[model samples]
Target: MSGADIANVCNEAALIAARHNEESVKLHDFEQAIERVIAGLEKKNKLLSPEEKKVVAYHEAGHAICGWYLEHADPLLKVSIVPRGQGALGYAQYLPPDIFLYTTKKLMDRMTMALGGRVSEELHFSSVTSGF
Candidate 1:
């Protein structure tokens, strides 16, 4: 990460810790900060129709399922259909493997994991939604 990125994380994590009345910036605070940085803040007030909500839930669940079953895919940390950042309708956080290098199989597994959401939508709804 760059110097600015590290600084941003520290500032955000400290704010999160303070909001929670913690003595120090904790690991979870850092994690939340990182997520906020990467995904933007959770947009809890965003409204979705029931049908859209169902679709988003299914899409995220598809990601979780694929990640869980794929040997080289990262393990899931959490899944949510709650709108996040500017455009994310749903997300599945994974405890990614620490290694930097990716083998061919691992790369393919990652690609499959990414496609899980759309594949799920196709399987359940019989149609794929636009965008990633």
Candidate 2:
């Protein structure tokens, strides 16, 4: 994780511990904190048009489906469409491996998953946009 990510997780873990009247952050606190940090605080107040919502939903679903079936890809944990941290309209969470080196198949699977959204848009809408 990056320095900002570590800081955010620590801060969130601390808050979680305090909320439950605990003395220190536990494993569960860190897990929840990581999820919160990655998924980001939901933009409850953000508004979207129905058409935009449909498009985003489909795009995110495409990513999830692609990751699910791609054998060499990282294990998918979650997917979300809530806008967060500036212009991030959506994201896909994966249980990444620790090692740095990657095999050719792994890279290919990653590429396939990355392109899933655009493929989906083309298949469904017959045209694509750069919003993703």
Candidate 3:
């Protein structure tokens, strides 16, 4: 099965679980979904090439670093270079305990942090990819 197919299956499962009024979907379910996608990618031999992997790593690392540098930005939760069902080459996840109204400066800072990955990739590699 393709990564997208596995993701769709996971989405359907989550939807069904939610509709059934389950108290909470287990974390194991999410892990299973991720594993399925990763396995599919592996079977397809679509694992990123070395250069692409480095690009993805640096791109994700930029987001985490920039977010950490910003005063009002959330803390970095995780960063991954693995391709997911959502078709993303990488992702940088953050955790903000609370959402509060933002000042203009804060909003700009947030936007800057959000764009940090693309900017860094371009700056470092002298090129940009569709993945960005």
Q: In model 2, which regions exceed 4 Å deviation?
A: 2-4, 16-32
Q: Could you give candidate 1's per-residue lDDT for residues 1-132 as a string of tens digits?
A: 679998999999999999999999889999889888767888878888998898899899988999999999988988878788878998999887679899999999989999999999999996778623
Compose the digit string of candidate 2's lDDT tens values, residues 7-117: 989999999999999998999999878877877676766787887777777887888899999999999988878776556677788889897999999999999998888
Indicate the worst ten consecutive residues by lDDT in candidate 3.
36-45
Better of 2 and 3 by TM-score: 2
Clashing pairs in 1: none
Q: Each model's TM-score?
A: 0.80, 0.77, 0.63
- Candidate 2, residue 62: the lDDT equals 83
Give the TM-score ranking, best first: 1, 2, 3
lDDT of each: 0.87, 0.83, 0.72
Clashing pairs in 2: none
Whole-structure CA lDDT of model 3: 0.72
Candidate 3 ranges beyond 4 A from true positions: 1-45
Among these predictions, the greatest TM-score belongs to 1
Question: How high is the lDDT of residue 110 in model 3?
Answer: 78
